[model samples]
Target: MNRLARQSLLLAGLLLPVLPLAAQHVDHAGHGASHARDPMAAAIAAPSRTPANVARDKYRHPAETLAFFGVRPDQTVVEYSPSGGWYTEILAPLLSAKGTFYALQPVGRNLDGYKTFLAAKPDVYGKVKLVPFPDQLSLIPAGSVDTLLTFRNIHNMVMNGTEAATFKSFYDLLKPGGILGVVDHRLPEARDSALEKTSGYLKVSTIRRLAQAAGFEYVGSSEINANPKDTADWEKGVWTLPPTLRNGEVDKARYLAIGESDRMTLKFRKPAS
Candidate 1:
C-alpha cells in the first residue's frame, strides 16, 4: 500500500473510539443541566393537579418548600405519612417522567384514601408506589432512599410517642448524605416539650434536638410556611385556626382571619460516613 493510504487508515482507527466518547460526554452534561432546572414550577403549574390542592398552595408554598429541600426529579424519594396525598398530587406527576415517589403511609384507615386518590388519577400517579409504614419501618431497605419528606405530621408522632423512633427510621432509610425535609406546626419559642403532646405546635429547637439525637445532622430550617400571625395560644390550640376550626362555628370568622397555624420547615441530612 502507498505510504499516504497507510497513514489515512491509521488516523480513521484512532478517531472512531473518541467519537463515541465525545458524544457520551455531551449527553451526560445535557442530562445534568436539565435535571438541575427546577421541575416544581412546571409540576405546580400542571393542569392535572386537584383544584383544592391548588387553592392551598398559598399557605403551603409547595414550590418554595420543595425547592428549599433541593428536591429534583431524578431522586428516589419517600413522602412519609402522606395523609390524603396533598403533596402527592404535586410529587407523583413531577417525578412521573424520571424518578420514583413512594407514598409511604402508616397502616391505618387513611391507607385506603391514599390508594383511592392515586387510583383515580392514573395518568399522573400510575408510576407512584404505595408503601406501608409499619411500626418498625422495615418496609424500606436501609440506606436506599435519596430523600424523605414529612409534612405536618411530626406533632402527631410526638403525641403518639413515636417521634424519636420515626426520626431514627428516617435516618436509617436514607443513604449517606441523604436529605430529610420536615414541615410541621411551629410552637412558640420557650414552650415546654410537655405541651407538644397536646398542642399541635412543636418548638423548632426541640425538633432539631430530636433529629440530632436520631443521628441526623441539622442542615438548616426555613420559614416558608411560617405565619407570624399565629399567636400560638388558643382555646383549642392550633386547631382553632382555619381548616380545622375545632371550635366549629363558635368563632369561625376569627379563625379564618387568623389563617393556618405557623409552620416550621426543616432540612436535615445523614452523615456521609
Candidate 2:
C-alpha cells in the first residue's frame, strides 16, 4: 500500500474506540448524558403511571433516587411497605422483564390498596411477587435479595416501635453485600426526638444508628429528594406539607408553596461475608 494509505488506515483504527466515548456526555447529576436513555427514566415516563403520580415526580425524583440506589432491571429487589404502590408501578414493570420484585407490605396496612393497584393492570404487574412482611418474610428466601427499598415509611415504623424488627428483617432478607436504599422525611438533629413518632419526620442519625445496630454498613446518601422550603416543624408533622396537607384548606396555599417534605436519601449495605 502507498505510504499515504498506510498513514490514513493507522489513524482510522486509532479513532474507532474513542469515537463512542466522545459521543457520550455526562450530566451534572452524573446520569442521562452518557447514554441516549436510561431504563429507569423510561419506566418513570411510562404512560401507565397515573397523572397524579407523574405530577409528584418533581418532588419524588424517582429517576435520580432509584439511580442513586443503583437499581438495575436484572436484580432481585424488595420494596417494603410500598404505600399506595406509587413506586410499585415503576419497579414492578422495570423488574418484570428480567428481575424479581417483591412487595413487602403488611397485611393490615395498605395491602388491600396494593392488591387492587396490581390487579388493575395485569400486564404491568404480572411478574410482581407479594410477600406480607413480618408475617410472610419467610416466603422470600433468606439472604437472597439484591436490594431492599423503603421510602418514607421509617417514621411509621418508629412510631409503631417496629424499626428494630424491620431492620433485622431487612438484614435477613438481603444477601451478603446486598444494598438497602432508604428515603424518609428529614428531621434536623436539633429537632425534638419525640417528634419522630408523631410528626412523620426522622433524624438521619436516628436512621443510621438503627441500621448499623441491625448490622448494615452505611453506604452513602443523596440529595435528589431534598426540599429546602420545608421547615420540618409543621403542626401535624411532615404530613402538614404537600401531598398530605392534613390541615385541609387552612393555609393550603402556603403549604403547597413549601412543597413536599425535605427527605434524606440513604443507602446501606450488608457486609459481604
Candidate 3:
C-alpha cells in the first residue's frame, strides 16, 4: 500500500475499538432521554398531585415517605384497601412498564363503585391487577411481593379485629427485605384504652405492636403528616374534615381550618434471611 493509504488504514484500526464505547455512551443518553420524555414524569410533576390532591385530600405525606421506603418506578407493589384508588391512579401508571401494581382485597367485597371507575378508564386501570383474597391473603403466594402499602386502613382492620391476621398475611406475602409502608389517622396515646371503632383514629403504639407481632421490624416513623392542631376529638371523627365533611355543617369552617386528619407515616421491613 502507498504511504497515505497505510496511514488511513491504521487510523481505521485505531478507531474500531473506541467505537463500541462511544456507541454505549450514546445508548445510555438515549435511555435517559426516553425516561425524561416519559408521560408519567409529566403526570408526577404536575401540580395537581402535589402537596395533596384537593379532590382527595387524605394523602398529604411529604415526598420522603416514598423515598424513605426506597420505592422506585420499578417494583411489584401490593396496595391494601385501595379505597377509591386515589394513590392507585398515581402508582399504577408510574409502575406501568417497569413494575407491577396489584390491589389486593377480599373476594365478595363491595367494589362496585371502584370497578365502575376502573372500567371507565381502562388505559389507566388496566395496569392494576385486582387480586382477590377469599377470606385471607391465601390467594397471594408466599414471598412474592416487593412492597405492601396500607394507607389509613389499619384502623379499620383494628376495629374489625383483623389486625393480627392482616399483618401476618402481609408478612407472608412480602419477600425478604421487602417493605411495608403505612400512613393512618393518629389517635391520642391516652385513648388506646378507651377509643372505640367509631373514633376513626388509631394509637401509634398499638399499630407498632401489631406490626411487630406480624414478624416485621419497626423501621421508624416520620412526621410527614403529623398535625398538632388535631386533638383527635372530632364528633364525626377524622371524616369530619375536608373530604368527607361527615357532620354536614355543624362546624364546617372550624373543621375545614384543620384540613385533613393528622396522620402517622410508618415504615416496616421484612428481615432478609
What does candidate 1's lDDT look like per residue over 1-273, in tens digits?
999999999999999999999999999898666655757777887788879778889899998999899888988899999978889988987888889898889988398888888899888889998888875466678899999999999888888988888898889899999999999999877777677888889999988989999999999988899998898978677888977889999978888887888999999999999
Please give, for residues 120-219, the per-residue lDDT of candidate 2 as tens digits: 9998887889888778788999999999999999998899999998999999999999999999999999988988888899999999999999999999
lDDT of 2: 0.90
After superposition, candidate 1 runs with Cα above 4 Å error? 1-38, 135-139
Candidate 2 vs candidate 3: which has greater TM-score? 2
Higher-ranked by lDDT: 2 or 3:
2
Residue-level lDDT tens digits of model 3 in 39-110: 454335434342445344335642456666667777888988875767776777777778888888655554
User: Which residue pairs collide, candidate 2?
Assistant: none
lDDT of 1 at 234: 80
lDDT of each: 0.87, 0.90, 0.78
Clashes (N, CA, C under 3 Å) per candidate: 0, 0, 0
TM-score of 2: 0.86
Best by lDDT: 2
Error of 1 at 102 (Å): 0.7
